[model samples]
Target: MNRKTLVLPAAAVLLAPLLAACGGAEDGRAIVVGTTDQFIANEDAPAPLDPAFAYDTGTWNILRQTVQTLLHVPRGGGEPVPEAAQSCGFSDKASESYRCKLRSGLTFADGTPVTAEDVKYSIERVLKIKSDNGTAALLAGVDTVEAKGTDEVVFHLKSPDATFPYKLSTPVAGILSKDKYPADKLRDGFDVDGSGPYTMKVEREGEKAARFVFTRNPNYKGDIAPRNEKVELRAFADAGAMGKALESDDIDMMARSLSQKQIRELTETPKERIRVTEVPGLEIRYLGFNTKAPSVKEKAVRQAMAAVVDRGALVNGVYGPTAEPLYSLIPSSITGHATPFYDAYGDSDTARAAKILKDAGVSTPVKVTLNYTTDHYGAETAQEFEALKKQLVASGLFDATTRGAEWSTFRPAQKRGDYAVYGLGWFPDYPDPDNYIAPFLDSDNFLNTPYVNKVVRDQLIPRSRRQADRTAASPVYAQIQKIVAEDVPVLPLWQGKQYVAARDDLTGVEYALNTSSDLLLWELGRGTA
Candidate 1:
């Protein structure tokens, strides 16, 4: 699944003026990458930079570059390959026990030896700390992590999990330096000391800021090689400004933040200087119902809302061709994707939705509030929400009111169950079908809803994950999707297509856009001109 690209020599560090003069590096000069503010992470700030506490995409981008995991998905998009681990496999046929052997002579950035103890400590710390909004769900099946010796670590699972190896490849399973981080609590700082592909250097105009610099990690023992000696991630205020910077040669690449209009415009007008790569992404945008809320507590009310949602119109009207309608929680590219919602509801029929509500003994025109964040999802989100409101109100089964919040406020409030129904987007933590089903449906989910379906959390997901062959688990996933469609705790709105727009001279752009939709910053470099 991973692709390898031709790598060039590290570029010599250039002065500020010369760096901004060209999109590609002059022979042996650094390449500066420009991105929207969304991609930048503040390591110095308290925005959850620690592996145990971090879950956001910006932090994941930084972590993927600066931290090494036991295994990792290749840049070209394939199965998990050994990174820090020299080798890894299930010790038992039931997949109840898994083990890994660390590469010899591995050391942290500070020269401390990385042993199996460090691996055990990292996993234990995550389980012990247990951040409310973090990625603990990824390791739900893990019973214990024990260090057998200096090089060997064993994972004892409560049940068989075929996809356990893929989980270790995520940032959630990033190995940490036992000497640098505390064992009891989460670590906080501007400095990074992990063994990964790159080492970060933070520069701030203020005490706490997002912008920073990354250089190739000399101590890194992984397979990936840095194409540029230094990579500068410059953050702009918005997508429009980021696009302008790319057009004007202020930045070499625009990473994952541009709107549909901007992408189409770049495709049509620029024809020569810029190149865009659109790949099918695993990210899902959905509407989550807070089951605790009075307005959405009834199963019938939730079903009616789901029945009236026009996913086709939402994609074509707001997101354009950059995204497609998603009827199942698992996206189309994944093996278990089945159109249960589409089959059950059938293209936003208002009369059917009205009849469903009336038959449930509910009154006409149920009033409910919809919550969404403007800054987090994208600039196009406001339009998407407005379109959703129109779709619901037009059905005449409900009186929908839409509200907006900035992401900083929105995330905590949504988790607190403040909204009757809310819009949330998910970028996959791993590529497995279990990832789509487990995290959202489990009782102890990130959504913080009062939904506890034993059929899904206890039975279906466990059965599905235990199957080594994902194709064998497809029917179970289809059943899970059908249950989701019936309950309507969340409505699958759309799945996005990944796009990375860079100057034509940039090589390794394909390598950067991996299957997980995470950018491999190290693979991107200037082409010979």
Candidate 2:
């Protein structure tokens, strides 16, 4: 929809400027925001705000603003800083023991004291529950979490992990009140007892309940100060609807759901009306193979398929300039990113791929099933997979069939090995090189792929995590990337740039799009027109 066609009445438009002049807090209106259906769907909704069970970005988006972590990665990104804790540090040079002192007089939204015991309980609960899709995997290094005293918490690790501090900064490690959450099971319902910048204002139900409201938390003890008294998160069916809402000023900002077409249009035509914030790329889209599938069980076949697919064509044709061809699981902006796929497969080499298949005693026109989620990865996903099918069929070495399901069904089916090959996307929990390497390669990885290399899982990853300076550990990650490329468990497709579109009058849009690819709602504020 065009700017002139926006549904907002002229009276409201005129009043908005006057309201901004009077200040955002005086009106007692929530700053409305919108995202795509995939975010608010029954399978993907950020409900049951229990930090221990909350793993998806939708959940983390709200938790990051409403629930405080011991440490937090700053907006532009860098070293972690104290959030709930007054200060935290490694107790020994080996980096095996870590300790943090809780800030004095910390309290949840309900006014219960937040102490070191709550921090310990929050971490212990995650490990104890260990949900299949939960972020507990990120804390695998920790052997135990102990409350040394009323204000002090200590962590004992199974081995040295230099990235442990960064892990604490993630939503998975968000400190929850022991009194609010039970020790044995995930907390029920949408009620949140968080101590971050904002707290839940209203928990609505039924067909009409499409928005979640949050008001400023009076008990927040962190560095973040809420710029608006209230914030509202609204869900939309698709990018077109979200764009229309943005144009009509129905929402103050749109996060993580705008399509490439919408993004490009808003960026070019009405640049003055909306401010678009692009954070450094950290998201990776890749093709995963289920090794148990007979058609792709052979390493040579997998390598040949990788060789036939052109990443350059996929990125430029399907994603436009919104993404870049990624050769490794790690995005190029991050340190230790290696283009091993380029070194091994080069550009689509149909002849070489055919030869490899023939050499492996595999016949021409090998049957393969390619699976993708239509709603999970945005509107371009179907087109992207179609492009892949076209390229693979053009090679004349294999017959590829494409199928799709909505995210809720797609995720579980993929994990259950329902597809021979599938598409997946990853937004890192932390920016460290280990976060990219270890998650996909470890023996018990999130991918559930049969491929596993001991050198990577047992040696390279451990060696890299032990290094105090991540730069010193770069070569190890490079080595791991090369191994991953060679194994072809998953083919790296492209890395995406983060975008947040807000009204021109909204302040702190850039700060809200943090380097971790998380939208920090607390950073947003209204500005005078």
CA lDDT of each prediction against the hidden true structure: 0.79, 0.79
TM-score between candidate 1 and the true structure = 0.92
Please give the lDDT score at residue 346 for candidate 2.
88
* Candidate 1: tens digits of C-alpha lDDT, residues 1-529: 1221233234522222233344244576556665554432333225357888777776677788888999998754667999999999999999999999999888887678889999988998888887777477778789999998899999999999999999899888888987777877777655666998788887655433346688777888876766666777776667888888887887777876788887787656654577776655788999998887888888889888888888888999998878999999999989988999999988887878888888899987889888998777678988898898888888888898889987666777887788889999988877888888887887557787778889888888889988998899999999999999999989999998777788777766756766566878877667632
lDDT over C-alpha atoms for residue 27 of model 1: 75
Structure candidate 1, residue pairs in collision:
1-77, 1-78, 2-76, 2-77, 2-78, 3-76, 12-28
Cα lDDT of model 2 by residue, 1-529, tens digit: 1132213356765554355444455566678777664433344333445777666676677778778899988655788989888999999999999999989988888898888888888899888877556467788889988898789999999999999999999888988877777887777556667788888754455422366688888878886656678888886767788888887888888887779997787767755577665656588999999887999999888889889989889989988888988888888878888899989988799888988888989987988878998876678999999999999999998899899997767877887788899998888888888888777877546776677889988899989999988889989988988888888998988898767788876755556666566877766667653
Q: Which stretches of candidate 2 lie over 4 Å from their true place?
A: 1-24, 37-49, 201-209
Deviation in Å, model 1, residue 45 alpha carbon: 9.0
Q: What TM-score number comes out for model 2?
A: 0.92
